[model samples]
Target: MRTACFIDGYNVFYGLVAGTSFKWLNLPSLIQHIVHVEAPESQLTSIDFFTSGVKPSLASRGSQSKEAQDTYLRALIAKGVVVHYGRHQLEARNAPRFISKQSPPSRLDQVAIWKLEEKETDVHIAISMYRLASRQASLPAEERVQQLVLVSADTDMTPALKAIKEDFPDLRLGVILPHREGTKRTTPGSLKNHSHWMRRLVTTEELAAHQLPERVPTKKRPAIKPEYW
Candidate 1:
């Protein structure tokens, strides 16, 4: 089966790699391995990674964090993963303040905050998936993508999956949640309901085995792994 993967990069980062040693991920290799485990005949044809650039002012490591993300993105590009960039919007907003677990948030007890939103990623992924499915409808059977795999636990993508499942019955859908093994994150029922199969967690061993090399060669200069990563 010819398969295409759509990855929610922001979702993957916070769910799997953040605060972990696996920041330097080899996404294609890891995804291929997982897909093969689910369907031995699957041939990964393409990877579309959707994400927003880091805001250096809000990042924990400031500019270093942004540089690390840039380097990693360059390495991913070198490996043939097509990246789609969304943008971050920083704005002053007001929201209910957190008190205690037992206390409900009251509108009167609001606080000023800097709200950072990642824009257009969900819509982009949905549109891209639907467009691919529509395009495949015109292709020769052998040239069409037989499978569509989504790598995210976000329920926002459920509608797209459901639409594909309804409109393209021949195309198999798969979902891979970015939750790492040993974590207690719940499997999203909506995503699983729309997908033909759902992989619940990614093993640490898989991440350890699929890290990018310290240096990745580019046309201009080599993209090296960040020292802090």
Candidate 2:
């Protein structure tokens, strides 16, 4: 069966950026890397990476950091990963250092921003799952893709996960989480029992060799490597 990989760009970023030398990752090559490690010689259809474009309101972290991010993202596109850029709307975060019920709290002059729901990223993942599932359903019985691999830690995807199974009984559905070794839940036999599915946190070793030789690749992985998709 034809197989495709769908990645939650932020989920992946949060999962891997902890220890890798490079902050950004190569989406398409990362898939090939994972496939080579887990199921070498298998057919790979396409790599879809869903990420938000830089917000116009993005606070400047100065020039050097921004340049690095731009360079890394560009490299990913150059390598063939489909990049989906979306807009960001920052939400208010309650600073722990200060608080109030009715009166205003003191400003420490420290500014911070966060989003409870990164709406764009969530929408992209949901939309992709639906679009691909629908597209597969529209194909001829024998020509349709029956394998989907999703990489994310968002609980938002659980509904989509269940729906895919019911809608496409013949299709194989799998979930891959990006987290460090000690960060994951204690293994259930299912994760171990699942022959065609799994949950993995990204490892530093994999991060170092984002795009590398398929056979006998360098094993000089990082010391605090985290497991990955």
Candidate 3:
């Protein structure tokens, strides 16, 4: 059976890879490993990676994080991963955040900060899934994709999944939840409820097995992994 994998890049980052040593991830290898573990009969045929560029204001630890991300993106393209980009937006609004430990909690205290948010990524992922499902539904069984794998913990994708399940009853859908802290939520109920199969977590061992090489050679230049990553 042929399969396609759709990844919500930021969602996976914050849910699994952030603050971890697995930043140099190899999407192709990851998909293969996932398929071997979760759906042995399925062959991964495509990968769609959705993400946004880094904002300028954020202070980065290593050689600018933006450069590192660009390098990674290029490497992914070299390996046949389709990259769909959104944009990061800076918003100024009054919002309540966790109180600082140094200061006493005050009910009236509010802070106005420049919050950077990635926009359109979820919408893009949803639209891509819808299009893929539509394509499959329109084609004959032999020509259609048998399975679609979604990697994310975002609840925003639930509606898309539900619709696909309703419309393409024969298509197999799987959800892979990025490994998350025990205190934090795992997969959203709606997403899991609609999927044919759900893998609750991505283990560290799997991540270790699928990391991109420290130095990835590209046509334009050598793409080096960020030292601090």
Give the TM-scores of the predictions, in the order they appear. Answer: 0.98, 0.69, 0.89
Candidate closest to the true structure, highest TM-score:
1
Worst 10 residues of 3 by lDDT: 178-187
User: Which pairs clash inside model 1?
Assistant: none
Regions of model 2 farther than 4 Å from truth: 36-41, 55-60, 92-117, 140-143, 182-196, 212-229
Best of the two (1, 2) by lDDT = 1
Model 1: per-residue lDDT, tens digit, 24-128?
A: 999999999999999889999999999999999999999999999999999999999999999999999999999999999999999999999999999999999
Report model 3's TM-score to 2 decimal places.
0.89
What clash count goes with each model? 0, 10, 0
lDDT (Cα, tens digit) per residue for candidate 2, span 103-221: 56666643566754456777677678767887986788867776777777767676676676667677776666777555654433333333267656656666666642222212232
lDDT, residue 188, candidate 1: 96
In model 2, how many backbone clashes occur?
A: 10
- Candidate 3 local Cα displacement, residue 198, angstroms: 0.8
Global lDDT of each candidate: 0.95, 0.61, 0.83
Which pairs of residues collide in model 3? none
